[model samples]
Target: MTTSLAPDPAPDPGLDPAPDPALARELRRERAHHDACRAALARMAEDVAEQVVTGEDVAASGADAEVLGRHLRSRAKEFGEQPPGPLFFGRLDREDGQSHHIGRRRIAEHPAEPPLVVDWRAPVSRAYYQAGAHDPQGVVRRRRFGWAPYSAGDTADLTGLEDEHLVSGEDVVSAIVAGEIERPRVGPMRDIAATIQPEQDDLVRSGPGTSVCVQGAPGTGKTAVGLHRAAYLLYTHPQRVRRSGLLVLGPNRTFLSYISEVLPALGETGIRQSTLDEEIARHEVRAVDGEAAARVKHDVRMAEVLRRALYARVALPDGELALADGPLRLRLPAEVLAGIVAAVREEAPPYATGRERVRARVVRALQLRAERRAGPLGGAWARRVERARPVSAFVDACWPRTTPEEVLAAVLADPDDPLLTAGERAAIRWAKPPRSFRSARWSAADLVLLDEVAGLIERPESYGHVVVDEAQDLSPMQCRAISRRADFGALTVLGDLAQGTTPWAARDWREQLAHLGKPEAEIVPLTTGYRVPAAIVDLANRLLPELGLGADVPAGVSLRRDGEVRLCRVADVATGVVEAVKGALAREGSVGVIAADEHVGPLTSALEAGGLLRAGGDGGAGGAEATGGTADVVAPESAGERLSVLPARMAKGLEYDHVVVAEPAAIVAAEPRGLHRLYVVLTRAVSRLDVVHGEPLPDYLAS
Candidate 1:
């Protein structure tokens, strides 16, 4: 029962062309199906709302009933409204003559009736994304529907359809995929549900317990794959994921805002998203450390140094312990008291826990000795001896309670402490010491140190899974911090080694994975560039040799080869950037002007002066105002004609339709890993890339 639409042709000048009856009939049938699905969804929403618990029931059942009622009300609110996107995008046809419409959510008229739309995460919808001519997987044909914008008070409209015959020996690339990829991006990043390639689908369907490390080049769709995997895991293992929770960690707030809408578009709303610094440091940090200091703090060896310094506080008692209260009198010699303290230290408990245990042990020993010499001491008398000033003083002197902050301050205060070797002291000691502990400034890397010490004192709670984006920039100690959070679970690590811009960036995936506590995790390399044009990617690939990617660097594949990479030399860099941005804005989609860290302020000012950048209180300046580090200036509106002035390092996971890069040589000279940072900035263009430079280009690029 396949319905095919006939192709319509233009009429000749002198003759009247007859309408294609089959085309009209097919359009009517599809329209009817769309209306029916909408009606069914409306009815489902009504049913959920009517089932809300009443106030009388809540009153009778007390607090538990009230909590349950509130949860139901929240769920009802979510179900009552529908978003603007199409409900169903694809349909799968099986060899057994069965058909199912694939959509973001499931919709059924009744319990006994077949579902009108099958959720994309359902097992039956796998063929829609994975089936091909070589391996049909029992699929006959897969159809993708094109949607028209919905009008006010109107249901969604299905305008057209494209089909790929799985058994016809044709290519997997369909017209639907080409249109979806080429569509103009007006707002935040959207889900690539309709255009997910076969290779990406494989990673998305990986099992729950499997930890995957994706070594993806620019435009390879790694971020999309990670988000899709989160949604897939939620569907496959709902109970396990819901109980322990799932988290997505990004590089910065600006990057987070760029991808904030992706999960909700994929029908997932409960997943928590945060930056690594935000997760590790819950409080506000006002001060920052320089690059040299941050590098030293982020080093993994600092963990060992911290451990030695913390445990150095525990020592043997130097004085005798004498406690006397009425009938209970106890006197222990210095040697015997030292032995007791040494025995407790041998157990290697936390400093605070060890102090409490020592006090209890001294009290018990005194009661035992008193009973042996005189009559048996009562429980009340033993309690009085435990509270005696002498017993408390002995325990405090032997095992002092310490906080993570206090211990970190003590380590940094003295440059020549024995716990730190001469070389280690030189590396970690502050160049200009703080006046006091209260004035000690903590950097982003220092936050990781605090998390590490907190972990050593007591084990941290573990999550079910963690998705870490831009993981190659994470230091060894930072990796350990993230690993501790998901110790018993799995991780989806995403990054390009060539894109790592930090001083302590990972050199290889094997060593980084070991630090993450998943040494055996599978490493998957995605070299295909589906988003960025080939011309732009080729320009960026020139830095591969410097990045140690070797001669086997994979060139990205682009469907549209019409993109141009322009290199211009100008007298003034700021003027050239403003002109380039104006030209890009005149075209379509968003535009980004990426410059070096020191050049962002001048570049932003120039753009604003030229009236190219909008100014009315957007988040454009928030990234610049952020403490510790520099970030991209994200415009509040990301729609048509929107512009973002970014530092080269902040362009990691973001893409613009057109990009203007200023002074390539200056970007390469900004930091130790500036070449890698420049490579990241060059490949962020989806359609075209314009390189404008006032100074000579880098040696690698010029050659």
Candidate 2:
């Protein structure tokens, strides 16, 4: 069943070499399969669009008919909106006949027939990623197809095929695998369904109920793994996921945009991707925190401090409560009221629930008193007793209504708290306090504290699954916010400790996972470089000790052999950067020109002066502009625009074919964890890394 292609013919003296007959013939067969699958997918979309919901069964109910029609239309839209690419990317041949071909989304010709293309996320496709010459997993051969620019099954789109004979125990690496891995990364991050490695596949297929934490180094494909896990959960547990929801938390909007296309490319749509600040925002961020103030707010102890401040609002009733019961007034002593409050507080329910429980207990006591006085009472009497003004007033005064902003404001302004010293409180307190909670100008750190209060006030709604990337930089308080949403469900935590650049960045995954409410979650380490080359990874490893990664483990090892590392010194940093970017632009794939935060402006001007990085004069910056203010994202992802100029911090989660880093010392001096930030910058190059500096490079990076 394996169709092997003949080797290419050797070239004659000055004549063009003839195409291999077997290669040409196999390409034809693959194209025919692609066209057939494309046509069947179109037909499936048409069938959904043509569906008729009969009204006869529900003639009296237009609502039922409208709902059914909307559902059909939604299905039609989903089918039509599937990303246009090769229908199938890989195929597995087995004697037991487990699969026909593996694709992004399944395609079938008929409702009851076996699919023409099995979804890559399907259980049967594991062999494509995991099977090898040593462990074939029941597969005899595996084939990968190479695709050209997408054009609805064009004549040349399906161009080449390569295969591995598992039964022969041949260990040669396939040329197609290498080509796909080293392919140019031009647009938004694409789905790696075609190049997923065995280790990554294990993480991607982690069970729906299992929480996992991935400590992936640069170019380890953790981001793609997290996204694919979301898609996998959506497919495996559609109803549960749809009922509760699925969410992905990234470090910034720029990261969110760079990965926005990944899920959709994998046939998943409408997933809620957001940053932690966006999720926990209670007010507009009109204030900023200094380093010390931010560290105080992000401390894990802040969770308990906020909880105490919120509960401090609750107090015992000062006096007796008089209840009018069936024309007879009843008086409950303050001692009884205090007892009820104590009993409910002892239960330790949510703040709001505690209030409700106390009120209910008071109502019950009043009912029992009424029943004793009049033998037996109806439910109507209890209702009147519950609605009494005296009862409402008593409960309101004891356990008052409040908001997250109110609690946070009170805690910040209160100088008497032991948790915060005099100077600490003064540092965090509003220098010019707002008129009230409504007009309060909250900082990003303040929003995280507010989320803590909100969680205590009432448990935040739970999601079926959550994927938090760049988790190493999340402070303890931020992890609490994510934990609140996934309290009852699972998580896919992804990050690297060496990439932690925040003042309060995590030093260990165990402590961070504890804050995420998944202390026992399995921790998986991925240090193999897939997208990045070995030279760049080796260059980054020099900073590992400075980043706190111990020497016991290998820093990282890239599987790629072809990569370039160049360190150049020049008299002018800006001019040197311009030349480096220009040189990189002449090569294939996207280029990223990164510099220190303060240096981005000068570099931007230089790039524009050199006739590069043109935004069409305010027409728009496209993807770069849409990334918001997370970083100084400069260049747009426009036509013929292969270069993205950004600050060092913004390069944390992004990769390019060739990267240009300007002034290594400046990047290392920009912040407290500048070395970690520099480590992140240097490892972003997939093929080549050019470090251009006017000053001497960081000691760690200097050879």
Backbone clashes counted, model 1 = 0
Report the C-alpha lDDT of model 2 over 1-703, residue by residue, as the tens digit.
2222233231111111234677668668877888888899889877876773332345545887787776676676677678777788899998686656999998999979999999998889888899999998889878877655333445355556777889898666666667677776666677889889999999999998999999888888989999998999999899899789999998888778778888888888888999988898777898889877898899888887888888888899989999765577788889999999988888889999988888888988887887787778777777777778998898888888888989988877663567877777777776776678788878889999998998998998999999999999999999999999998899999998888899988888898999999999999989898888888998999888776667423477889887999999999999998888778767766777788988888887888888766643321112232321122223333345466677787787877888888898999899989888988899888889999998877676777
Q: Each model's C-alpha lDDT?
A: 0.75, 0.80
Q: Give the TM-score (vs. native) of candidate 2.
A: 0.92
Model 1's TM-score against the true structure:
0.85
**Per-residue lDDT of model 1, residues 1-703, tens digit only:** 1222323231111111232566446557766776788888889887777768453255545777776777677557657444557778788889999999888888899857999989888889888888888888988888876554222213324445666788886554555556567554445677888778888999999998999999888888999999999989988998798679899999988778777777777666767999888888834686677666677778887888788777787778777778776655678888877777788778977566677888888888787788888878788876787788898777767877676777787777664556555766776677776877567787676778888877767668788889999999999999999998888889999998888888999888889999999999999988887788788877777778778766333545565555778898899999999888778867756677888888888887887787666444342221122222222323343332357776787777777778889998888888888888898899888887889999987776765
Candidate 2, residue 291: how far the Cα is off, in Å? 2.2
**TM, every model:** 0.85, 0.92
